[model samples]
Target: MQLTNKAGTPVQWQDYLKSGHRIFIGSNAAVPNALIDNLIENSAQLHDIETVHILTFSDNVWAKPEHKDLFKVNTLFIGGKNVREAVAEGRADYTPCFISEIPTLFKQNILPLDAALVMVSPPDEYGYCSLGVSVDVVASAVKSAKVVIAQVNPHMPCTNGHSFIHVNQIHAWLTAEQRLPEIPDQQIDPVSERIGQYAAMLVENGATIQIGIGKIPSAVLKYLMNHKDLGVHSEMISDGIIDLMKSGVINNRRKTFHKGKTVTTFCIGTQRLYDFVDKNQHVEFYPSEHVNSPVNIAKNDNMVSINSAIEVDLTGQVVSDSIGHQFYSGIGGQVDFVRGAWLSKGGKPVIVLPSTTKDGCISRIVPHITEGGGVVTSRGHVGYVVTEFGIANLIGKSIRERALELIRIAHPKFRDDLLQQVRKHYWVPTYQDNTPTSVPELGAVELKKFTLGGERFILRPLSPADERRLQEFFYSHTKETLMMRYNHHLTQMTRENSCQLVSVDQHKDLALCFTQRDHLGEIIQAVGRYYFIEASNSAEVAFVIRETQRSKGMATTLLLQMIKIAKKRKLSSLIACVRRDNAAMLKVFENAGFVRGYSEDFDEISLCLTLEETITNAKEIE
Candidate 1:
């Protein structure tokens, strides 16, 4: 086939077509619609033509029943209604692979390409045509294909980074002026919105994010509008990120890799989004291998990977690509980004999905994955899973603890059923019926913000699974500190003791741990707890801070928060049995407005605060 000039006609790509050839198409919206249509219209002349792509939009004609035989559609990743039906009916083949390894498959001839059909923006002054929107594996395919045919669309945006192919590299070109297809915004329902809000709370300022494409991601991005210097390193992004970039919220200033560039493999969004990436120096598009590589993604500090799941089991196993034996979507980049983000400094790998699907008809959180569902992310790789109800941190948690934490975040309507299933399937003798199994009606534990010595701390409720972390926290403290907190000369801290301390009844006890991030991971700086005294309608609280973190006002802040919760729970009073020598604890109690009470022992002093009375007095003064 002869190459065409820059100002080529629309049908010039037809010259490259032949029978018994394998063609690789661009992914998502970047699929060359005109070339695809031409291939289908001329299917009468072609036989056994293999078509390869990932997640094409509605414009694909070969996916129809009539053209299925003409083109053997082999999809790397599956989506859209047509491909779903085709795959279910055995008309099309679905290949399951991690998005990060796709480039290597093409480069190594594992998926040899006879031709590459791609959509590109009009050539710039240097005759370089950009692979707008979807760079992904197309770059590798084009590089290795026998022939490269491009639909030179004027409507396609000229993107930056490793997304460009010189006009001279094309074997044939067709000038097409149609607008790129838009992925319309999903209707953000109250449930999705709430889920987004909860997920957004985990995202910190100056964090590099990898958000998947869809309504949940878009909804989550909406809540991050006010976040500062957020960098994006996603596999696919939509319209929501454009606003954040425009408003200077996502400046990519703090990203260690691609420091000032929003990196992605592909994009799917509206026309406005196309215009935003056009000649935009801030965005860099890379092939899926480089973009989704766990090692590459981990180079950026504070990376947050927010992905979705079809369903998740009680043991933190995520089923994303399939439902039972039915294939839904490809493995894609969920594992790649999940592990990458988890490996990154201050990274959080979050799986955000609605608690229920199909208008709350079914719980996305299930007892098991229906026997045949593929575990896209294994329990070990899973860290955080978020739903509209709340966030469940599953890392370093036992099976029983993970079940309880996950059930706490399930939809309220399904919580009881999930709890019943958990008891039936995963119950142990150590499980106490009197333990408050539910996460309380007040909602998920809010991440309380507190600053000490110019450093910030996140004070959140300690879950039963926090045993390992609490053990580390305990070991980090000196014997003097431990003795003061435990009121004994305890020399050793075991996992069993830590597990007991971290475990709490939501209704009758509160265990709040103050944590901050360091180079290693999240470190517990302090722990405060209050156990209910049924006889006195009060709670006895205790505090322990790492020696280095003491006198930093964390103890005082924790006491105040305990009092607030105590009042909300309708507890009349708060008490603390402080060692006589513990001047720091005594000062914190006094500063928190606690009154010294009568003590039976000489070595300890009793402190009590009338929480209900304090709340009443404050309201009256107000």
Candidate 2:
């Protein structure tokens, strides 16, 4: 298959073409527009040529009815409007495959490529041209193809890693001074912002993340400005991360794999992002086979995968690539990252989407996916599911439990209907009413940050998922602290007890926890909660802190947060029963405006904070 450029006006690339040839074009923004134009211009010269690509732009020209006899299009993923229509009209075919395995399709000759037209950066001093933004499966395609053509552009960024190829490997080259295309940032809506806030709470400092490109990913990054030492191991990235990198919030300092480098297969972003990656050693672009390899991704500890979904069922099944039976997008690298991230030590695989669609007219959380919908992610693989309303932890939950958990996070307007469906489907215990009974929407609880002793601390409402953390906190407390809080000696803190401690009934109780995480992971430093006393406007409050964190004003801080929530709830007062000998606990409650009172039993003292009086006093002082 030796090839040589023919002398002509349009470069006569047709001279190198033949009937029945299988050609692959670079994906997304890296599509070789110049080479493609040449192919279309000479469409009359070839017959039955097969063209393969993923999420290509400007595909309508090639899929036109006039070229039906000459060319047929095969898309690995649909990224643009034209290709989607082409697929719907039967003008083109689509091959649904995971992005990670697409490279293998070429490597194994399952889809042997005759030629690969790609865009690349100009050859460096060593005669190596970088693949620029779209390495992905293009690297494998180039290797498997008999002829490789390149549209070398000066504006293309010369990224490192498996992104570079020797100039001699290309059969033909054409110079281009044009700027590469860009996927502009998406507008972040209110639903996306709420989902992002919850997703960000799961991302700890020093965790490696694999985020897709879209409005949700953009929104999620905005809330992470305060996070530290984050790393990227995603398939693609956009402009949202530029500020984080510049702010030193995402330094990739603690990654277990590819430490100190941001690894991605391709990038779809504006010129600013391209300029930042150009000749930047800190960012490495690898082939999809490598970047999306689950084995490779799992090597990074604390991997947090954030991906979007179209619809999820009550059973935790995720349908991301399609709406009902219609093809919307490709499987892409979502499954790759989801499985990889969950397998990583301390990893969190999250699925995020709005609870409703179409102006809140439809619920995305359904009892079952539309009749013929595909499940991109199975129930077993799903761990965390976040909607604008809340976060649902599905891992290790039973079918009955999953139904309850998902319904809890659904839009309130639809929860009642969803709950009825759940009850009909499963023989779960009956509730008094149709108001959805679920593990509280803990992720919706706002996180308050305060500085104590020059160290920042986060206080947020607790969720059922906090059972494990609460257990750790309980075990970490000394016997003396435990006795003071529990009013007796308790040696073990079981999961059931921990779950009860964190569970909030929204109407009757509100539990808040003070948490902080280091290299080991998130630890509950303290717990503060107020439970309603039946038939009374006043609530009983309790507080506990780890021995190591005591005497740091943490208790006072928790007390203040409890008071604020109680006041907002319009509760008349908050009461707490404390041991007479627990001077530290007594002082904390009193310091936060609590008025001490003697209990009927002398062994314990009652601390009460009258909200109406306190509010009046505060207003007066102000």
Candidate 3:
């Protein structure tokens, strides 16, 4: 409950927690093991213990699946590290927030903390040492932790930045020489290297770089060796950053936060990098909220955010998490950093990916997304998208141009098919399918499921535009129905015109009877009213909203009541020239026990039903 330091060399604490407030320790490679060991010794005395971190690789006691009775995790960004698994397994928890906001949340008492376990270098003669180059977000916590416990070590670097606080600020100090963990650098592909170049090209000098974990990001960093005074403020870093820092390319000179020092949420690089950060005041690690906040990232000058995606549609919708319906990864800091980069002065938000998948059967650049594909980055947020083939700047392109531009950058093998997909979706009339061969053009309405409602009322075209639907509907009708309801002799009518009979309410008494909810607790069981422009109550279809349209059952709710009025009035037996293929409407009348009869005057078929029969069908569903 107090921020007072222990006031002794190699300070120590006998009681870490004295109240409901839990001390939050940074996890991942930056975990303060000295403090953690002390915590274990006193773990039995603690209640409602909570710790927040992206991931950790220690004894795993803090968030072990078996110890849910004690520790809890409030993770920021997910990593392959232990803490992430503990959360997904339910031993811990996932609290989503941008990395940049963690420090504020800590300071504003949004996530109140009673203490903090930090690691740092031993103080110099002047009682000062660096928080190291990784000053990304830990500085905020250092300023706010009620009890600042530092793990002072000589191996830790003394890099310049706002990371260092005087020994007087720390309540307890746990001296140790434990080093930060290292994440190795793997090889990069030629195409990934090219894409990295393009992504890096957009980055101006003195820009803050936020890159994720991958060969692409590493490759992009490779191109920036010649760029001067680039700053680093990101979630994690590998060997790629070590060379830059040693080369004077990353001096952290232009950064707004932790100026003159490297800033990072955590580090996972090589043994060399690990040895370099051991008590080396140059490296610092903090929670993701401080590192990934949009506001925090925007503080740097000329911020450049480079992120990767699975696929990007012509409209610039970036899908980075899924293959289709499967969940590949969670929505992480791409959006956070992208927004931050966009808001920074002279910032550039870029999405970099290969033009096609590994197999090359499918193009990474599509005209539109697959069914149920999630849009991780919206069209408006996208600035630059680059693939091996070319760079697409969809920032201001029209929908049509976007599609063509994406297709142009698509692998040659799949470009034609994607263009055809464009024609099918947007319904751009007179669309050319880019390919020489004629591919049957499909409509934009993706995968239509046969809703039970389709049986009751047809989407009969109201005009020539409806002819296509009529042709499709009638083609599925029975021969007997074709001859009875529609034939060459009848008007060359389509489904659109067939539903144009009349209003169901021809009688005054029965007009309002069926509008009420049926026995099934549904209101649209039947409707009766004057239907067509002619008010032809003489013929009516006693329609019901089918089961398929249950929640969205807007159709039958109106038709059911309409049928009641038509039956109440002795209106010409309620004529109907339904297509023989119209099964839904047929079910309505058939279930109601209404029989079909041919019209001699119009040479068309119709149905006649009594008031009793209309009530019977409406009641059956109820």
Q: Pick the candidate with the highest TM-score.
A: 1
lDDT string for model 2 (498-617, tens) is 656655665568777778854224578888888887677989989888888777887777777667667777888899999999998888788777888879979799988888766322
Identify the superior model by lDDT, candidate 2 or candidate 3: 2
* CA lDDT scores, all candidates in order: 0.81, 0.80, 0.59
Tens-digit per-residue lDDT, 1-622, candidate 1: 2236445544443456677778998878887887677666555667778888888875567777888667888998988888888899999999998988877878888988889989999888998999988898888888989889888888888888899999889877767777788878988877778788888878889999988766778778998987898999999878898778889999999999999989998888888888888888888899988999999999999999998998999999999998899999899999999999888988888898888886788999887787789999999998888987677887677787678778767776786677677777644224423222443533543555567777877777776656668888877877788788888778777766766776677667888878885422567898888888899898889988988887777887777777777887889889899999988789988877888989999999998898755632211100
How should the candidates be ordered by lDDT, best one leading?
1, 2, 3
**Compared to the true structure, candidate 1 yields what TM-score?**
0.86
Query: Which structure is stronger by TM-score: 1 or 3?
Result: 1
Query: Runs in model 1 with CA error above 4 Å?
Result: 1-15, 201-204, 342-348, 358-363, 389-445, 471-500, 518-521, 534-536, 579-581, 597-604, 615-622
Error of 2 at 434 (Å): 7.9
True-vs-predicted CA distance for residue 399, candidate 2, Å: 3.0
Instruction: Give the Cα error of residue 321 in candidate 1, in Å.
Output: 0.8
Prediction 1 global C-alpha lDDT: 0.81
Clashes of 2: 0
In model 3, the Cα lDDT at residue 383 comes to 76
C-alpha RMSD by candidate, in order: 4.2, 4.8, 22.5
Q: At residue 419, what lDDT does model 3 achieve? A: 67
**For each predicted model, how many residue pairs clash, with residues at least 3 apart or on different chains?**
0, 0, 63
